[model samples]
Target chain A: MNDPKSSLTQVRDRIDSIDRQIQELISERANWAREVARVKGEGLSAIDYYRPEREAHVLRMVVDRNHGPLSDTEMVRLFREIMSSCLAQEDPLKVGYLGPEGTFSEQAVRKHFGHAAYGLPLGSIEEVFQEVAAGHADFGVVPVENSGQGMIQITLDLFLTSEARICGEVELRVHQCLLSQRESLEGIKRVYGHAQSLQQCKTWLRVNLPSAECIAVSSNAEGARLARHTDDAAAIAGAAAGKVYGLKTVADAIEDRADNTTRFLVIGRSLFPPSGNDRTSLLITVNDKPGALYDVLSPFAKRNVSMNRIESRPAHTGKWQYAFFIDVSGHIDDESLQAALKDMGPVAEQVRVLGSYPVALP
Target chain B: MNDPKSSLTQVRDRIDSIDRQIQELISERANWAREVARVKGEGLSAIDYYRPEREAHVLRMVVDRNHGPLSDTEMVRLFREIMSSCLAQEDPLKVGYLGPEGTFSEQAVRKHFGHAAYGLPLGSIEEVFQEVAAGHADFGVVPVENSGQGMIQITLDLFLTSEARICGEVELRVHQCLLSQRESLEGIKRVYGHAQSLQQCKTWLRVNLPSAECIAVSSNAEGARLARHTDDAAAIAGAAAGKVYGLKTVADAIEDRADNTTRFLVIGRSLFPPSGNDRTSLLITVNDKPGALYDVLSPFAKRNVSMNRIESRPAHTGKWQYAFFIDVSGHIDDESLQAALKDMGPVAEQVRVLGSYPVALP
Candidate 1:
């Protein structure tokens, strides 16, 4: 056996060498994460695309190959952070959501980006898309529908008029909150929230806050924030806003419906190859006649493509007619989908593709 | 034809008769809505006892009997309003949610209650649930999970430790936004939002407002309202708050991930017989062993019951001991489910039922 001093020296030298290699490897992995972020970023800029699955797949592979104390899930989670940081380094994507701060839009951004994206609060749905279109940000997140309230008409109109393609989708679980500066609901003057939120809380507001005026805000988050700043003013928003603004919750769970939710769409510059479970959105104007509407929809009916949404809006061009916005299952690239579009050409005046994206679940 | 005056008189009498019937009918319907709301109110106070399907079915029947300009869907919608109003009147169920205002929690309340709920905002998750248990409110709403951000540990903890029961659920589409008091982010010095939101917007915050301090608030709504009140402060919230507070959006869609969403849970009194598609939650403690977990879960496997969630929390009373909170797809009253619980007795030190309720969806 070697002497104790000699053995210690040998071990120290080996340890030093290993530490250097580990540091180098970490730096290399970080660089790779940065590179991946750069590529993804370029695509996002020219076209709105964020491939979460692909990135996740890569992280999984890296974690599996690692022979360390960290578990694969933990390792992947850590790597996700590294990758997110890299993406941020590449290009910061600005998102516009209906706002004050604690609104569902902010929650949407958090759900979409995890903890690595910047959430921008916007005043309206149009402004959200406009920010993305004008290059002020990489993507726009807007609410398209609600389970109880139905669709957000303004968002549908944006889809009808904008050239932006639908890049992604997300489902958010919404919870309405009652906020007041006072500890109790006594002597409350006004209840503030979005029109939809106010409508949802109508029954409760009427019963409990019978004398209180129900004021509409642009977003639930905004209402919460505003309530924090005003005296005797109550706002309906998420609990997050109350904590953020240091406001007390006078009550909770005030919605008339129990299973409420909102579906949001991600819009960007370009579209991607359809994932099998794709939903396509389009806008069409048919001749203002009885069966003209039926004719435009016949193609979809014939092809057996399921129509998920069908809404009509006035053609804003001063024409004595309305335009229909349709959303159907299956990608535009599908044979039947193409055939359906072809068949609808003669039944209308104008047709535009709103884009195809994956279905979302919450 | 008869004399014009005499004919007019006859017609006027007929019209008056019709009008009297209409008024009586409206009053009757309104009263019925209140009664329905009362029945539903009992369900809210005891949410697990609330069968959404039953409520929906009843409301559907009411709509089917309606006669007038309103279509079947419209009639049902009106009935929904009545039911919601009635429910609010019953107990005026108060709820606590993470807030300032206008956050997804408010939206979730709207989704759950239809268009009639009394939403309350609180400073934190604990605060929200605390309101429910303390009788300050009838129920509470809080975010439990996110598509991008994963589980909300705080809510999980509340469920694990609190006396409140899981009554309902709401999934909302999250839409994030960027708002500033000014028109642009050019001179923004600070970005405000909840901690989770700040983390979600990390990439964008680092890039655009690189030098800006990202302050964590309770909710995004409050953050936006704060921004509205202060100069050089931008808030990440939703549009609702902006409309209420009159804040401008500077940038939008700044999340690192494009598909973001948050899932919220409704908490209230003990559950009763579930509606269709039920879920049961329970907490169990097991002896230390290699296959103890497997043994505890074996009952579920044997019964062919699908388990949705299984999480472990450190036992509050001991060190190195943990309690498992499990959610499964079966009612406790089911033979198989009861048998599973009986079988679990040997392996578990203690077992507590959280609740058994219908699977509410968006």
Candidate 2:
């Protein structure tokens, strides 16, 4: 609401008034969610406070209708946090992720669930899965892939044994930085970093601090922690991690690759209906023979279904048998997908549906 | 070679004789590789020393023909090194990988190229690609995926632009250990590790050193270095890295997930023919329309080609066009695969064949 005739003071007052209305609207929306939670909690043994399908639907709408000075992604990220704050009012969502502290997995959790969700750092990916499966946490955030690296195999292997399913997906661009509390990059005797970050910023360290002894630590945050106390040491981490340890950045965005990104999945115990645009993951093993894999995939091919991902792992059996993990387009609730899956059953030794989830907007 | 009763002096002589024979055989193999190189290099202006298809075939043969107390994988690993040594006689394979020395990428490079191939640690994945593409290196070894994590998007995205192709693949089982110069874990004040390792050993650290501050460093090797010098610091890293910095393992195999692994790709300047059992990776951008993915995939489905992996990325454009990176079951040289690609051309906006290489043995 802008007025050309308004003085500077009047404009400032109008801005403040608009801000108050926005806060009121947000509060009202949160109140509605709280009431909905109350109504849904009754007559049900358990009310799934975090409905991924519903959240996906809302985010899609927000992104689709946005026409702004702020980019669509930026708008969606803002709304996501607002929705996260609102969702917390009903019940603060508990999220488990892989970490000691300040890990990408933790960042993924914060990014997707927003500031309102309680973030719990687990020891490992399996622990994150167990935390959700055992009911200690409402949801789990685990990295499934990094754009620079390939898939995280342990996450996929865990799905073979865990009942937790994919409820949503999120991706964050990974930008590594060289951080320090030191006065300069020069005169640094040692550089601390995580293994990945060390690798990511390998050249910069070599060229900039040729004689500094490079060391790898647990996380970028941990690297920054050591950098804070060690006089001549600098840590390679992210800008966020640098702040967590109160370390100043000697150099930021030092990763060798600029477009590096990581994709994470949100896991929960239950599955829900489709959000129209969705992706489904499955774990299957085919009969160990010539053309065995072909048979297993034929059904989806015949049905005009698009298979998104198929990864193979050795079955760990002494023999050469293998297990296949697959991701395909469409939700299981869709009729055509159901028919395609039925055909997969006979050809595969075992076919377990991991989960059907909304495709990530970004 | 095994002299059951040879522990005594007389038997020791017999063992020595067997060792001589083994050395002679290896030398002979190297001589053969040298001779092969000489003949191949003649009359050919452009020569490829590292034949990924040929190496894959040999490794396959080594496993297939094995009859031993050592498992197939173990036997194959031994042969891989031996082959690497033999190939080096022609010209030591120069491989560049992401590293600050003693990184898992270095390990992967060593594992694939063997002791003879020169391993160069480049600072970035982009550098690794550039090294190979610019003819500065024979091949570049970089991680494409990890078991606990998913695909390395940087690698895939790089593939979108680089002319280098994937020729081989290798996987290393990631085992994080707690290393320190200290006598025991009790007095530990700070545990240093790579971000991945710290999380991998989170549970173990929490149980043993509840109050210890966990720090992240550049690489596990870097962590080992920090732990070696810092009296109260312990590093969670691989045994190889611990040995590099002479840090003793306070605790071994501390990763929460037992089956943690990282997958790496061998990239070179040109493509190679199939090695019987092969996997092909491709970069495909689909038309911006509903069912565009389905249409591109339908060709493979119709031909009964077993598709291995397909992932989606937003095609950096104004209207959110998407790119599909895929792995399928055969080399591009295969008739059926060629037919599938021919069919794919019409449905997709752009298609680029990444490479075809043997599936990892382990």
- Tens digit of per-residue lDDT, candidate 1, span B129-172: 87788665567788887866777777777666778888766666
* TM-score computed on alpha carbons, candidate 1: 0.41
- Which consecutive 10 residues in model 1 chain B have the weakest lDDT in total? B18-27
Q: Which stretches of candidate 1 lie over 4 Å from their true place?
A: A1-49, A52-83, A175-196, A203-254, B1-362
Candidate 2 per-residue lDDT over residues A226-296, each given as its tens digit:
78777788888666555434567777777766767788998998887898899998888765899988888
i-RMS for every candidate:
32.4, 33.8
The TM-score of candidate 1's chain A against the true chain A comes to 0.66
